[model samples]
Target: MDVVRSKDGTRIAYERRGSGPVVILVGGGLDDGSENEPLAAELARHFTTYNYARRGRGESGDTAPYALQREIEDIDALIGEAGRSSRLFGASSGGALALEAAASGLAVDSVAVYEVPYMADDAMVRHWAEYVDQLTVLLADGRHADAVELFMRLAGSSEEDVSGARSSSFWPGLEVLAPTLAYDAACLGDGQPPVGRLARITQPVLVATGGGPDPHLEGLRPSFFDEAADTIAAALPNAERRTIDGETHVADPQSFAAVLEHFFTSSGDFRQVSL
Candidate 1:
């Protein structure tokens, strides 16, 4: 893993692969670069892939008093390290970060985001804050599994499914990263009310959601995905929205790769081709 220091001196780690125009992939809560490893390998076929670990995960460093702006700076540091304008793909909370960075003028060639949870409604914002507080308490009690379950439940996951997944292979890692749940909550905030501050993004943007026709989890509403798409479409200067039919929050790599290829390869402004 290659390392770069962010503006606040936290070490950001990333792995570079393949050999073409650069495309940096950012993962969401509790996720390191490994979360997108499969997708990155697929993209590597056509672009130089930079699979980055957001601060505090993998080989990255974490300083006390973390701020959302520092996370944005981590991305900027990667773009600068790439030494050229690079395409960015962020998932969930990571998607929110990418949009924030682009709006802040990071010189990204293009941006692609999947299922970012943004809401403009005030009621939802208040509800989200309460939920965050609940999860924080769960984490404080060393109930990582319970915290994960609560988060999934808040995201609309059914109790049965959460229980079922608890014994699965994925749950352990998610529990391990449970404490960082606050980081994602901070990135998302109450209802993710428009950082009305983001209308400045001029780079071509692609906003996507899962079309699997199911809520993220049982009991949780699907408003997060809907509001996220609406927010990006309304705020970005040049943006397109797509729904990946039959896919959900946990998308298959092949489906994700195809969506990425269609957007990044066909977006003429970013990558020029020779016939």
Candidate 2:
């Protein structure tokens, strides 16, 4: 693992692999970089991939009073470490963070995101607001386990599965990462698509979704991911919308990596669909 010091002096840990154009993998909720290693390995075949533990997870050091910009600084540090502008692939809420980074005008060459977890309707927004409130309270009280379970339930975990997970040895590991859930929530403010902010990003973006239903979000709404993807694609000045057939919220890493490779290697002009 390699380390980079962010602007705020937080020590960010990441593993760099492969030998080509740089692509940084940003993992979403509860991810500690390990979850993204599979996708990173696949991308590494053609791109030099950096799989890093986000702040507050894995081997990365955390600072007090986390802000969304701090996470952006972390990405900037990684780009500096790569010694050039780099493309980014962010999963779930991490996707939102990547968009934010690009919008902030960092050294991002381009971006690709998978189901950024932004809600499409008032109902879903209200539901997410409740989750945010509950999460905040739980974390404030330091009820890490409850916070983790609450997040699991929000992600559409079955009661039985939640019970099993709570008893499993991995549950403790999850608890340690619970605090970052708030960080992801902050990335998707009010659970609405940040159209204005997204429009400001001039970099080429690939906004992707799965054609199949997302079981993790089934209880919330139908075609939620697709709707969010459409909104994002429309909002962006330069973007393309692609739906991966038979893939749900959890994408097939190999297939997703292929899509990314194609985009990253291209001239980044997706003229077919763009605002």
Q: What TM-score would each prediction reach against the true structure?
A: 0.88, 0.95
Q: Write the per-residue lDDT of candidate 2 for residues 77-154, one digit (tens) a residue.
A: 999999999999999999999999999999998999998889888888899999999999999999999999999888
Which parts of model 2 are misplaced by more than 4 Å? 214-217, 268-275
Q: What is the lDDT of residue 129 in candidate 1?
A: 81
**Highest lDDT, which number?**
2
What is the C-alpha local distance difference test score of each model?
Answer: 0.80, 0.90
Best by TM-score: 2
lDDT of 1 by residue, 1-275 (tens): 99999998999999999988889998997787787999998888889989998887778889878788898899889988989989999998888888877877787988999888776577777878888889878877999888878778777777678878898988888887787777888787665645475567777888888877665454646565866687767766777777777888867887788778878877554321111
Candidate 1 residue-wise lDDT at 58: 79
Per-candidate RMSD, Å: 3.9, 2.0
* Model 1 / residue 119 / CA error / Å: 2.6
